[model samples]
Target: MNKVKLAEGVYYVGAVDWNLRDFHGYNTPGGVTYNAYLIVDEKVCLIDNVKAPFAGELIERISEIIDPAKIDYVVTNHVEPDHSGSLPVIMAKAPNAKVVLTEQGKSGIMKHYQTNYDFMIVKEGDVLALGRNKLHFLPLPMVHWPDSMATYLDGEQILFSNDAFGQHVCSSMRFDDEVDIDQVIYEAAKYYANILMPFGKLITKALGKTGQLPVRMIAPSHGVVWRKYIPQILAKYEEWSSGLTKDKVIIVYDTMWGSTDQMARRILDGVAAAGVTAKLYKMSVSTRSEIIAEILEAKAILIGSSTINNGMLPTVGGLLLYLKGLRPMNKLGAGFGAYGWGGGAQQNMEELLKAAGVAVQPGLAIKWVPDAAELDRCFQFGLEFGKSVLAANK
Candidate 1:
């Protein structure tokens, strides 16, 4: 394989897992990339490492350019296993390479591996001189992880932005310009919605600190290296980090038989008639990550379910649980559902929605199967909710 260079001496030595289908519980249909860069300056620095299983591939890529033993420093931006799981393998190859990371990162690595190495603890504004080029460290704790940080190469003007701008995409092509921009952006958005949404405040802080850098390229620890779409991605990060939303609504539900399904379709119709972008997802069929991505920019999220055991179905319960953990910002929420006897689905949904910090709006509950009148009422409720979304967004 040809070495992918970010600059004259800096090279991308990452490993791609095209077969990966899921990340923890989040769906990753497009797979993932564990991006690491090898910068062959006077010090010969390796910026990050890939997942442990891909250690050989990462080493092979490094060997193609230079000897692994010559690597003077192995910089870890995050202690996430996917990024640091291969540390032992890489350290074995370069026995003398000093491990570089934040203090918390050092603790994480030690606890994770149950082994210790020569660790260089760094903090914000710390610089690692690598010949003519220097790597500047910015400690951004809890942007996604307590150990998370970003490294900026001064002369090359590339920000190795750890997990901040990452997307879970596996492609042979390395940079944003080489792939379909739309797909990259979509995956990037999904990444943010799932992984970074809860850290909006910290991300805003991360963006503020990194925004001061003269960033010519953003090379993250996952997905494509961003060179052509820096401004677009930065704008999106700013928007998402600021909890901005669009005039769109997302309706997600789990159906027992077909009554709640009917209500969902009718709600979609009403939302469309109200002149707003709307998306519908049957929770049983759709990936939670995908639906969450839609909810990322949506003005409101409407959850529905067929009442089961006087509460929501497991899938609806699961999605709400995940949403509450993520705690998406700047959104309204409502619930609608069908029940044969009791009315607990919508109430439970709204309660979780409130816990997720969503502004609650009045919801709809229909008994048994919806008759024409009840269905119309559902539509009218949707229309009013859509109008409410418009008003709230404005």
Candidate 2:
């Protein structure tokens, strides 16, 4: 628990959990923070709510500073349960609180919670006065969700970014100036890759429109608030929003015996020799979501599977199907594997990649056991593919 005074009466009251591990199945190596702010002015307003389990902690923090009943407004920055799961309980305590949100946000809340509460529907540029401070609503639908909107506090120069520019990172420090920069950036990238990668175009457009606004602090729904390095994060978002990726290769495979795994390792070695970053993930244990995140970031993806009953391995087949549906852009794809009786999985993966509009490289297939000669050929093929990807990018 921590509080940061942005303006005379405006404060950021949020819970930081440096020990958080699992966030909706996506790994949070750096932990996460649930941020909520309180504006104590002529008409008190609370911006966002912590998770339900932490509701008592939030109430205690507010009670220590001011009475909860005195709160006149509750700003539902997002209707997602992580931020709004505790709303019912909080509103029960502050009965006079009017929930401030957009029309879409109101509909989302009712749909998710099955409650009809009084809501003040706001559009872009709409302003609400809180005596000394002013709240301006900016509608940013599909920045990630249809109901997502941001509130900018005029006097404090803080933009209450609901989920945009946020990371699932927990830290004792409340601002970027006080936290480790590299850790925050890595977590931020993971968050974007997992959560916001699909909305790249919308994010680009939103950033362009919001770039003109004067923002001194970025108070996101999750993670520490951005105080000094707002531009740094904004620039990163802009770069990621462009859907640009580095020259890298990912070899994903599932093996019946050790043959397929051996082929994957050779390909990885070739990729490294070609001066590209390469990563390996076995489909047997890796989650599809994690692979999708990597797929969204990598320049080239190599898929491999042993043929089971003249078809691709079940896990690899499912991944190929998932990748096809995602329709990742600007990707060079290839396949590799080993088979005993009938070798077809490698060819099948290549066809799937082609069907999904990926630039397919000539796939490599080997017998049950790849001899030294076959391994050398596969490695050379991988090297050629890596160079081709870099040349294409150039």
The prediction achieving the highest lDDT against the true structure is: 1
**Prediction 1 global C-alpha lDDT:** 0.92
lDDT of 2 by residue, 1-394 (tens): 3556766787877677677778876777677788899899898999999888888888987877689989898999788888887788878889888899888899989998788877888988789999988999888887777888889888878899989888888776778889888878766777777677767888888887678779989989888788888889998888788867789888899999889999899988888889888999998988766677677768999999988888899999988876775566678999889999887897789988887668997888898899999989878988888898789789
Clashing pairs in 1: none
- Candidate 1, residues 198-265: lDDT per residue as tens digits? 99999998888998889999999999999989999999999998999999999999998899999999
Model 2's C-alpha root-mean-square deviation from the true structure amounts to 2.5
Clashes of each: 0, 0
Error of 2 at 87 (Å): 0.5
For candidate 2, what is the lDDT? Answer: 0.84
> What pairs collide in candidate 2?
none
